[model samples]
Each structure stands twice: as C-alpha cells, then as structure tokens.
Target: MNAFAPTRTSWRPRSLRWQVMAAVIAINLCAALAALVVIIANARRATEIEMLSSLAIGARFVQETVERIADEQGGTASLAQLPLHINGLRHVRIRIEDAQGNGIDLAPASHDEADGDADEVPDWFTALITVPPAERDIPVVENGRRIGEVRVAGEASDEIAEVWEDMTSLAVLALIVNIAILAALYLVLGRLLRPLKTLSQGLQELEEGRFDHRLPPPAFRELALLAERFNALGAALRLARDDNRRLNERLVQVQDDERRQIASELHDELGPCLFGLRANLESLERMTAYAPVASAAERVATMVDILDRIQGLNRRLLRRIRPMSLGHVPFAAVIADLVADFEAHSAGRRFDFVSEGLAEHYGDSIEITVFRCVQETVTNALRHGGARHISIELRHDAASGMLKMAVSDDGSGMRANALPGLGLIGIEERIGALGGRWHIGSTDPKGTRIDILIPLPPANVQAESAERTVIQ
Candidate 1:
C-alpha cells in the first residue's frame, strides 16, 4: 500500500540457477504474504469482538453505578460525578450525556502505537498488515429515564502489538526454513548438473577432432540416452574421415602408376624409332652432297630439315611424358628447361613465369602435377587461344598447406557458351581427383584467366619417405 510494493511486471534472471532461485523466493514470498493477510484479518475481527465486549461491560457498570448513587443521594447524582473516569479509561474512549444530550467529560482516548517495531518488517509487509479500527455506541439509562450514551472507539494498539509479535516470529522461522531449503536445493542441483558438464566437455573434444571420445552413461535416463547418441555420431564421423583419407590416397597412387607406364612406353618404344629416323636422314643428306643432280640435293636437304624438326618435337614430348628430371634435379631447373623450349618454338608469344616456395622438393606426385598443369595451360594459351602474352603465377602457401596457381593469357578468349576443350577438361579432372579445386576466372574477349588451388598434405606427410626407400 506504500512505496515498497513489487512492480506489476516482475523481472526474471537469465542464468538457470538464478532463475530457479528467484522463482522459489517469489513463490515463498507470495505464500508468506497470503498467510500474513489471513492473520491480520483474523486479528482485526478478534480485537473488534473483545473491544465491543469491554465497552458493553463498561456501559452497564456506569448505568448501575449512577442509579445506585442517585438512590443514595436523593436521585440527583451528576452523571460526571458517578465514577465516569472508572469506565473506558484503559482501552476505548467513552462519552456520557443526559436526556438533553449534554456532554460529560471523560478520560482521553489512547492513540495507536505501532507494536513489535514497524521497522522490523519491510515497508510493504507493514502496509499489508495495517487494520481499520472498530467504533460503537451504547445507550445508558437510570430509573426509567434516559441518562446518557457511551461511545467507544476501539484502538488496535494492544491487539495489533500482539499480532505483530506473532507475525515477526513466524517470519523469522519462515526465513530460516527457506534458507535451509535453498541450500539443500543448491547441493542437489550441483550433483544433478555434473552430467551436463561432462556433455559440454565431450562436445568440445569432438570439435577438436577427437572423434573417439566416449561419454559414460549418466544416472538420469534422458542424459544416458543423449550420451549414447553422441557416441554413435562420433563413431560415424571417425569412420567417414578414415574412408575419405584412404580414398584420396588410392586416387593419388593410381595417377602416379599411369604416368609411370606412359613414360616407360615412350622411352622403350618411341625413343629408338625416332633415333633411327634421324640417323637415316643424316645419311641421305651426306649422299646428296656428293650427288651432282641439283633436284636430288634439294630433296635430301628438305628431308634433313624435316628430321631436325621431328627430333626437336620428340625431345619436347619426352619432357612432357616423363618429368623424371624433377626427381633428380631442382624443380626450378626443370621449369627453366620447359620455358626455354616453349620460347624457342613459339617466338611469337611471350610467357611470364613466377614461382616461390619450390626450393625444397616434394614427392613425385606433387612435382608431376605442378609440371603438367603448367605445361598444358601454357600450350593451350598458345596453340588454341593464339595468345600473344601469357602470365603464369605459382605460389605455395606452406602455412596453409596449399599450392595456388593463376594463369592468364591475352588472347581472343573463348566465346561465351563454348564448351571447354579436352585439355581444360583433363586438367580439371586431375586436380579434382587430388582433392583440389579450379576456376575459370574469365573467358571474355580480353583474355582468359584460370585459377587453380591444390591442398597439399603436410610436408612431413608427403610420402617422400617411400620414394627414398624405393631409390635405395
């Protein structure tokens, strides 16, 4: 009723523990308030009843005393002089008057004094327990003549003091009980929440790639089921990761095997045939130097020139078939050789090459992939796109365990909606099979730029140890 009432809209705590605690306190407070209302109501009623009974007794006492005194004093006793101070002096105030309603002065009515100390309770609590006073009046008579009226105003100071004392004791006991119960609840909640803490730690471990982590079943049925499900999911993820790792390894192995076979075929079969052709052409050109026929000499010279071109082409093809030089020599040397050969053949197109992080050699699979990708992209830029200027950038991000390459050509770029050639398609498949990605940056009239990104296994895990063992 005063300034200490709770807001109509109550606030709630965010944390689970605080939320539960706040809820319990609110419910208990409401119950305590309700009991307080009932006690105050009953106390008010009882006080009014007791006060009325006292006032009735006081009125009768006054009337009888006045009649007795008048009989002894010749029926002329003053109502004020009839021991009026003896009536209603301790509790309620009483006024006496004659038939003409004349006033008879009596003792003063006592003012209310808050009992058991108002400050002991909260403002809201004190306001809630305040009670209205009771008032009554009774008729007084003497010798069959109306003498006066006795008016009573019940002040609840005494009764309220008693109620306040009872409520204060009850409040203290309620507070003690509430605190004990809250402490017990906190202990129980801590034990009950242990399984949740375990679950949280298990989740963090799973995120860190510890898929083998398993949580023990909890005491609660719901938590036990959750643990079981989490274990199952972790098992599934571990299995999937193993399968993916094995699959990528198999693909890399197959790719290397195919390259080895092709290199073997070119060296054993194609190498000898080309050598014999060059020898025959040299012999024919020498005989033409001795022959007198001008036409015959010209024909032989033409054959020699054709043989030289074929030999150059064969050497280039061998470099493509087997980049074994990269295994024995620095990767930069092999790259330099390839660039020189390309520049010799295509004097019209200019090629720009930039490379970093290639000083240390990787496994054969890694080297071959890089060499072939560069070779084919440059060839396409010149042979297919007729590019005049081509730029190639090769960068290895050791920190990220990735290799990045960008090739752009200033050529009449492939027309829109045109299908990519076999060269482009083969590169895409090769990179994808190695778990890498590729993008055709642009294919407009200005130029075509191809971007390639390959994730490398960590340097320590590049399978170079197996290659070293094979060599030994």
Candidate 2:
C-alpha cells in the first residue's frame, strides 16, 4: 500500500475573534467617514454664509461713509482726508473713482496678503474651508448726479488663515476621537468575548470525552446564561458518560459469562458423551470384523463416520460462537491462521493475506475489531457473493495513527441495489463501537472490497478501559 498521507494546505479558516474585530472596525470606519463628510460640508456652508454677510455689511458701511464724507463742508477735497481703509489690514481693497475718472486707492498695505500668504495648512484643507469671494458696488451722489463710487469686497487673510487652523484642528480632533472610539470598541469586544474562548476550548475537550471542563458564572446577563447552559451541558454529558460506562461494563460481563458457560458446556458435557459413542462404535466394528460379518462391519464404519462428522460440526459451531483462541494468540498470527483455515476448508478457493507497515502490536480492542471485521466480510463474500478467492490487506499508518484493513474477493461481487445483511450490519456496528469507519467498495465483474479504518490511540492508552471493547 502506498502512503496515503494528505497534503497540508496553507489557507486557514478565520476564527470568531478576527471576524468580530473586522466587522467592528469596518462598521466604525464607515460611520467615521459619513460623519466627516457631513461635518466638513456643514462647516464649509457656514463659512460661506458668514463671509457673504461680512461683505454685505462692509459694503453698507462704505456706502454710508462716502455719502457722508462728500457732503462735508470741504466737499471733494475732504473726501481724500477720510481714512477709507483700516490699519494693519490688507484684505479689504478700497478704491473710489471720481466723476473726473481719477481713481483714489486706500489699502493699509500695498501687497494683497490674501493672494500670497504663507501656506498655513495643506492645499486640500485650505481649499475645502475657503468660501467664494463676494463683491458689491455702491454709487455715491452729492445731490442727483453721481460723484464717486464705493466698491467693497470681503478679503480677510486672517480669516482664511483662521479657517485653515480651525479645519486642521477639526481633522485632528476627529481622528483622535475615532481612534479612541475604535480602540475602546476593540477592548470592550475582547473583554466581552473572553468567555467565548474559554467556552470553545471546553466544548472541544468535551467532544474528546473530557466532560469535566466547566464554565464559571459570568457577570453579564447573556454570558452568564450561556455559561450556565454550558456548565449544565457538561454535567449532563458527564452523567450520560458514567451511565453508559456502567451499561457497557455490565454488557461486557454478561457476554464474557456466556462465553465461559458455552465453552465449559462444550468441553465438560459434550466431550465425554462423544468419546463414549466413538468407543462403542469402535468395539462394534472390531467385533463385526472378528465375526467375518461384512454387512455389520460396513454399518459400523458408517456409524463411526457419522460420529466424527458430529464432532467436527460441534467444533465448528463452537469456533463460530466464540473464537476463544483469538484472545490468546498474537493479532497478526490470528489473521494468518484465518487465511489458512479458509483455504483448508474449501477446494479451489484461495485466501491471500498481506500486510504493509503494520505495527507488531496493538490494544486488545484493536485486535478484536480487526479480526471480527475481516471474519464477517470473508464470510459474507463466500456465502453470498459466491467468492472462490479472497484477498486481505492490513496497513498501519504511523503518521496518522490509523489502522487500515482491506478485504476483497474475486467473485460475483455485491449488487449495487442490495441492502446489507445481518453479517455486514454486525460488522458496521462493531467498527462504529470502536470509533472507526468502514467502506463498502466497488461492485461489478471487478470484485467486492470492504475496507475498515480504525484510529489507534497512543500506545500507553490500552484496551483496559471497560468501554474499550466489543461484546462479540
């Protein structure tokens, strides 16, 4: 048998922890993005409204000043005397064009700081916070004809710089808040899910027949309910396991007792009776021979033949009921004996046995399960499949700790639609009891094969446990 080891693959299934964390982070990121969009949009709209209001109010003030100054006693000469621009401000550019077309310019600084101020923040942030510029014109007239024009537009370098600062601060604050919220969410989820980890480990151990793992009471309502349920489940399993162990023990005891009784009856009650009958027949045959009675002698020989046949039938029945020698012989040696016996009993029928990398030893339960499965399959093949030749192969995979045995017959093979009979069902139950599995192999003119695989525990764990056995 070639090594049937499975190749290891790289992809691993995601666990509950990572899945939950991913979902949490994904949801938080989406919420943060939505909030950011809304906040920036609202702030930008508010900035535009405020900038437009500043422009409107500044225009009204300029219009009122031009009208008031031109009406002064000095008239147009005094118009130049008025301070049209504020100190230390370069954003608001004030220009007055007189009726003579001469332009008067008033700016605290010559250079427009709004156009080329040192970049306060990144271009993207500045652009996001800036509002569209607004301009308004007011015509100044002394009486009826227009004297001069006062134009006002909002241009605040300090305002744009201040907006840039506010935006940067808002972004930093939002980032810190999002980080804090996500971090807290991560920690809270980890803490809340702590019980799940413990519960998972406990369930795994429970599945492996370790029923002692228990969960303590949790403070949270949902977790506490889950913990209580888990603990209860463990307790139920432990109770069921103990009960099953007792039942199995009693069943085993009864089976062993029946075997002993049958063996004793076959040996003590039937042995002497068959011996006496054989002795009586031998005496009669000798007496007939001495008397020269041919007919009598033939009858006596026929009687002796009948007696021998009965004894042979009895022994066969006993072997079928309980192969007590199976317990005494080596497991591998017993299989070799089975092949020899099958070939010896039937003419023109062959039984071939082969093994590959099989351990020289195993627990008694393993021995029993292997032997019974082979025996039943072989019987089914000969009796039902009309098999004349059978082949058996045994293998033990060290890496996987599994014992694999295959039994096949070169015969009519099994029908596809045929349901399993008593023997096959018995085989299935036997293997299941040992926590093993079996496969009914292919059909047709090819052959019939029955394969059984049993996982072997560590060498230290023997069949000493009461539950580690089969009744048959």
Most TM-score-accurate candidate: 2
lDDT (Cα atoms) of all candidates against the true structure: 0.70, 0.70
Clashes in model 1: which pairs? none
TM-score of 2: 0.52
* Cα lDDT of model 1 by residue, 283-393, tens digit: 666767776677566656666665776667568657866865888986656666676678887877687777766545666776788788889888888878789988777
Residue 233, candidate 1: alpha-carbon lDDT: 93
Model 1 misplacement above 4 A? 1-15, 30-134, 137-150, 287-472
Runs of candidate 2 with Cα error greater than 4 angstroms are 1-28, 74-79, 84-92, 97-121, 129-132, 139-148, 156-173, 289-472
lDDT of 1 at 306: 57
* lDDT of prediction 2: 0.70
Give the clash count for model 1.
0
**C-alpha positional error of residue 78 in candidate 2 after TM-score superposition, expressed in Å:** 4.1
Sliding window of 10 residues with minimal summed lDDT for model 2 = 463-472
